[model samples]
Structure formats: structure tokens, C-alpha cells
Target: MKIFEMLIPMTWEGLKVTMSVFAITLIVSLPLAIFVALLKGSKNKYIYKFTSAYIYVMRGTPLLLQLMFIFFGFHYIPVIGYAFTRYQAIYIAFILNYTAYFTEIIRGGINTIDIGQFEATKVLGMSKSFAFTRIILPQVMKNIIPSLGNEIITLVKDTSLVYILGVTDILKAAKSVSNTYSTFTPYIFVAFVYLGIIAIMTNILSSIESKFDYYR
Candidate 1:
């Protein structure tokens, strides 16, 4: 009971760190992903190639490796190295990694949209922007909701990787308590904490998915 009391506040602190990373990553990445997806589909070959290369590099690497490189490796650079804090490094890595993923997911959703819809919009003499905002984007979002939800859930778990940088996320907090008390109960408690988070996210995502069911 004493250990459980101790675990509660430490785990809550760690959960705050995890939630900050997840929320910031999602909020920042979503718009960037939309922009990148559009760039990937642009008529300008240079823009298309650059965005494609970025996506390839980001998606090709393991996120854990990326986090390490950003947090550790960047410190070796001449001028920019000194600017990165641990949290900054983690946020940069998470945003960049998830942006590539969200871009690809959005691109796939865009591609799966029927070409005839674009033609119909053009026939109606609507501007391209209008058509996309009014007609195409809604359907694309509907198609991609499930994939996006999976990524969000993954992000929650991935927050644990911040421990690599000594960021004191939930797992790290639990480990700290476990070490101090010489008991495994902290780990068990943290496991339930994580499970509770996942369950809540699953429920919320399911509700959002239901809102899009009208698309079908």
C-alpha cells in the first residue's frame, strides 16, 4: 500500500510528459501532413521529388533511432547543436516521424478517391480549392480515420521511447519507483495505467469512426 501510494504521483507526472508529447505531435503533424500530401501530388516535379525524398527517409528509419539521432547526434553539429533541449529534440523527432506517416496515409486516402469526383467538380466550374475542401477532403478523412486512429494509439505507446533520452516518461517513472522500493509493483501499476489509456483512446476513436459512418 505504501508503494502503491508512491507510484501514483510518479506515474501521473510521467503520464503528463507522455500526453504532452502525444498531443503536440498530433496537433502539429496533422496540418503538415496535409501540406506534404498536397506537395507530393503537385505538378511541380522539384517539389514532388523533395517531398517524396523526405517521406522516404523519415518512413524508412526506426523512430527510436530517429529520436536518438535528433537528441544525441545533433549535438555534434557546429551551430545548431546547442539549441536543442531534451524535450525539443523529442518533439522534433516525433513530429517529423509522424508527419511522414500521416502524409503517406493522407496521400493514400487521396489516391483512393474516385477520379470521377474531380471531374464532376471541374464540370461544375468550381475552383480546385473549393472542390477539395467541399467535396474531396471530407471523403478522404472518412477513409483515413481508422489508419489515423491506429497511429494515434501507436503514439501513446511510443511515448515510452522518450525514456531513451532520460525524459522520465511513465515507464521511466515506474522504473525509478521500482528501483527505490525494490519491488515489481510499480511496473505492474504502470502497465494498468497504459492499458487504461489505450482503452480510452480506443473508445474515443470508435466514436469518431461512427461519426464518419455516414460516408458509407
Candidate 2:
């Protein structure tokens, strides 16, 4: 019972850290991903190839290695090395890694869109931008919501990876308590905390997905 009592505060602190990484990554990565997807889809072959290579590298590598490299390797760089804190390094890695993923998700969504819709918009004398914004994006978003939600949920769990940089995230907090008390209960408590977070997110995402059902 006393361990449970101790678990509460520690878990709360860790939850704050986890949520911070998740929120910042999601908020920043989504828009940046849209831009990347556009670049990858560009008519200019060089732009498309460059963006494709970037996405390929980011997706091919493990995120943990990416985080480690950003945290440790950046110090070797001349000008930019000194500017990064561990938190900044983690955020940067998360943003870049997830942006690559989201770019693909967005691209897949865009591809799933029927070419006929574009033609219909062209017939209506709408500009490409107007057609995309008005007709294409909504349907793409609807198609992509399920995939995006899964990524968001995965990110919540992935935030624990920040512990590699000694960020004292939720799992790290639990580990600390487990080590001090010589009890495994902290691990179990932290697992439930993670599940609770996932549950809440799943609920929210489901609500958002339901809102898009009108598209069907």
C-alpha cells in the first residue's frame, strides 16, 4: 500500500514528461509532414527525389538510434552542436522521425483519393489549390484518420524511449522506484498508467473518426 502511495506522485511526474513529448511531437510533426508529403509529390524530380531519400532514411533507421545520434552525435557538429539540450535533441529526433512516417501516411491518403474527383474539380474551373483544399483534403483526412490515430497511440508509448537520454519519463520513473524499493509493483503501476493514457487517446481518436463518417 505504501508503494502504491509512492507510485502516484512519481507516475504523475512521469506522465507530465510523456505528455510533453507526445504533444509537441504531434503538434509540430503534422504540419511539417504535410509539407514533406507535398515535396515528395512535387513535379520537380530533384525535389521529389530529395524528399524521398530523406523519408527513406528516416523510416529505414530505428528511432532509438536516431534519438541517440541526435543526443550524442550532434556535439561533433561545429556550430549547431552546442545549442541542443537533451530535451531538444529528443524533440528534434521525434519530430523528424515522425514527420517521415506522417508524410507517407498523408501520401497514401492522398493517393487513395480518386483521380476523377480532381477532374471534376478542374471541370468546375477551380484552381488546383482550391480543389485540393475544398474537395481532396477532407476525403484524404477521412481515409487517413485510422492510420494517424494508430501512430499517435504508438507515439504515446514511444515517449518512454527518451529515458535513453536519462529524461526520467514514465517507465524510467517506475524503474527508479522499482530499484529503490526492490519491488516490481512500480512496473505494473506504470503499465496501467500507460494503458489508461492509451485508452483516453483511443476514445478521442474514435470520436474524431466518427466525425468523419459523413464522408462515407
Candidate 3:
């Protein structure tokens, strides 16, 4: 069979797996990150310390290693052992990893907001939480767009990492065809597909950032 003939359908099938992981991770992680960030910023020493350590561990480790542990290592942990399927393991790992990253991004963004905004809120008799939700967070979101854009693009590429669990993602599918046909065409084709996704993401993020231009 010609490489393209096999590669096309296989790549499409693989893309389905990749997009499912990516879409679900973003949906769950984005909001979860916000809640975690608030915990990380808490004045209660215990709460802050625990949240900080979790974020540190997640950020400090390699995501590939994390995925392996969740899928393989979890099987050794008493009752939860062998409880999750490969797909569920990947989802857990991806969501946990991205939530840590997005939390840190949000923290950095809140730091970048002008302190005077906080003072102004105080003058207006606003609670800190009220100010954060109604005022500060909106600007923090704008400030974090560039970082989020980069992370999101990285997520698209990282979807390929699911193959570590023997999940048939785009790169894995492409590899199967390449090995059979003895041609690099499958790899090149998937590279174009990846680039196309990143390009669309960049454009979407650019539009989102522009919408916040009035913040300045």
C-alpha cells in the first residue's frame, strides 16, 4: 500500500485520541488551576505550604516520568492498583501537570498587576475576594495570555506523549506507517498537522489578548 493511503486514515484515527486528551485537559485544568492558585496564595501557612509543595513537585518532575508513574506505578498502590485504564491515566496526568503550570502562570500574572488597583479596591470598601473576581483577575488573565498561549501550544505537541502508555496518538500512528513503508513521509505529514494546530491556536490567543487591550 502507498504510504499516503495508509497514513491518512491512521493519522486521522490517532488525531482523535490526541484531541480528546487535549480538549478534556483544558476544560478541567483551566478552572482547577484558578482554585489551586488561590490556595497557593492563601495567608494560612499550612494551606499555602501544602499547595506550594504540590505545585513544586508537579513542576519539578518531567511530565513523561509523571505519566509513567500514574499509569504503571499506580498499579502497585493498594486498592487503586490497576484501577484506571490507559486513557484515564493519561487524562489524570495531563490535567495535573497543566494545572500546576497554569497555577504558576496565574500567580505570576497577579504579581504583575499594579498594587494601586488593590488599594483602590480597599478605598471602595471591596473585599479582596471581590476585587480579585471583579477587577484584578480580569487583568491578570490578560497579562497571562502570552504564557498561556505558549503552554497551550506545548500541550498540543505534548499530546504525543500519550504514546508512552501505548496509546495510539498521532506520532505513534505515523511511526507505525513509517516503519512499515520505510519512509519518513508519515512523520513529515504529522509535523504539518501539528503546525497547523499550533497556528490556529496562536491566532485564537492573539484574538483573546486583543479583546483585553482596553485593560491598559
Candidate 4:
């Protein structure tokens, strides 16, 4: 309680920034992942290859590097330079990084489905897209929920990475308080705040997972 009294005012603005990054990344990346996953299976070689390369670049590289390259490095290039604002760059970088990961996760879920189902759809003379979108995608959503929850948990901490861009997130806010007070109290406060967030998130995810349990 004393810690909150000391830190909450100073850190409120930073918390807002952190939550915004997490929310936007999750909102945009989840749906975009489904689309990208479909493209990864596209019959057109070019589309499939392009998606593979994009995912490779995004997941193969450090997310911090992705943030730096977008916000700082891209500014040196013509046309692309000066295109996105700092805020936009932050969202874009986070979204792209998470989308690649989610895409692969979804693809993994898709692969876990039995091939016999695909054969069933073919035997029924149903189109591949229909079966995929209707019969397959929902089950994939259920299968991937736990995986997605794990990623979301990671994203909460990963939001701290934005401090590297001088975004004044909670970590940055804590650093300022720490410097001014010449104490580690601020970091302690920040850690508690993060734990509180993760605690709530864990509860919500458990509830979500339980809702799908009957299907199993």
C-alpha cells in the first residue's frame, strides 16, 4: 500500500502506454495471423514463399532489433522513411512480430488436425476452402487458445521492451523514480505491478480454457 502510494501517480501514464501496446498487438495480430496462415498455405508459389520469408525474418530476428530497425533504421530509407510516426512504428513492429509467431502457432494447430478430415471433405466433393474456413478453423481456434494464452503472457513482459525506444512505459517510469530517489523501491513497485497484471491475466485465461474443456 505504501509502495502504491509512492509509485502509482508517477507510473500511471507509463502503465497506460504499456497496456495500449499489449492490447493493440493482441487485437491486430490474432486476426492477421489467421489470414497470414492461410496465405502460407496458398497454392501460388510466390504467395507461399513470400509469407515464409516474412515469418522467417520476423521470428528469426530479435524483436528488439525489429523495433529498432522500424523506428530508427527505417527512417534513413527513402519513401519508407518518415512514413510512420513513432507511435505507429511501435504498434506496427509489435504487430508484425506477434503475427508471425501466431501464424506459425496456428499452422501448427492446423497440422495437428487429422488428414482423414481433409479426405472426408474431398470425398464429399466439398471445396478445400469451405472445409478449412468452416470445419477446420474453429477447432484450430480451440486448439491454439492455450498457446495463444502463453504468448499473451509473454507479451505482457515484452511490452517492457518498448522502454528501449524511450517510450516511458512502466519500466522507464520506474527507472526515473529510482534515479530521483536513489533507491530500488521503484523497481520493486514495478515488479509488483507486473505480477498483479499477470495474476489477473492468468485467471482470465484459465476461465477461457475451462470454457473450452467440454469440447475435449
C-alpha local distance difference test of each model: 0.93, 0.91, 0.92, 0.89
lDDT (10s digit) by residue, model 3, range 115-180: 998999999999988999999998999999999989999999999999999999899999999999
Given candidate 1, what's the lDDT at residue 53? 96
TM-score per model over all chains: 0.95, 0.95, 0.95, 0.91
Q: Indicate the worst ten consecutive residues by lDDT in candidate 2.
A: 75-84
Off by over 4 Å in 4: 1-6, 121-130
Q: Lowest-lDDT window of 10 residues in candidate 1?
A: 75-84
Better of 1 and 2 by lDDT: 1
Error of 2 at 144 (Å): 1.3
Q: What would the per-residue lDDT of candidate 2 be over residues 20-137, giving only the tens digit for each residue?
A: 9999999999999988997888999999889999999999999999998888887888877664788999999999999999999999999998889989999999998888877898
Instruction: Report the C-alpha displacement of residue 212, candidate 1, in angstroms.
Output: 1.2
Model 2 pairs whose backbones collide? none
Model 2, backbone clash pairs (residues 3+ apart or across chains), number: 0
What lDDT, from 0 to 1, does candidate 4 have?
Answer: 0.89
Where model 1 places Cα greater than 4 Å from the true spot, the runs are none
Q: In candidate 3, where is summed lDDT lowest over 10 consecutive residues?
A: 79-88
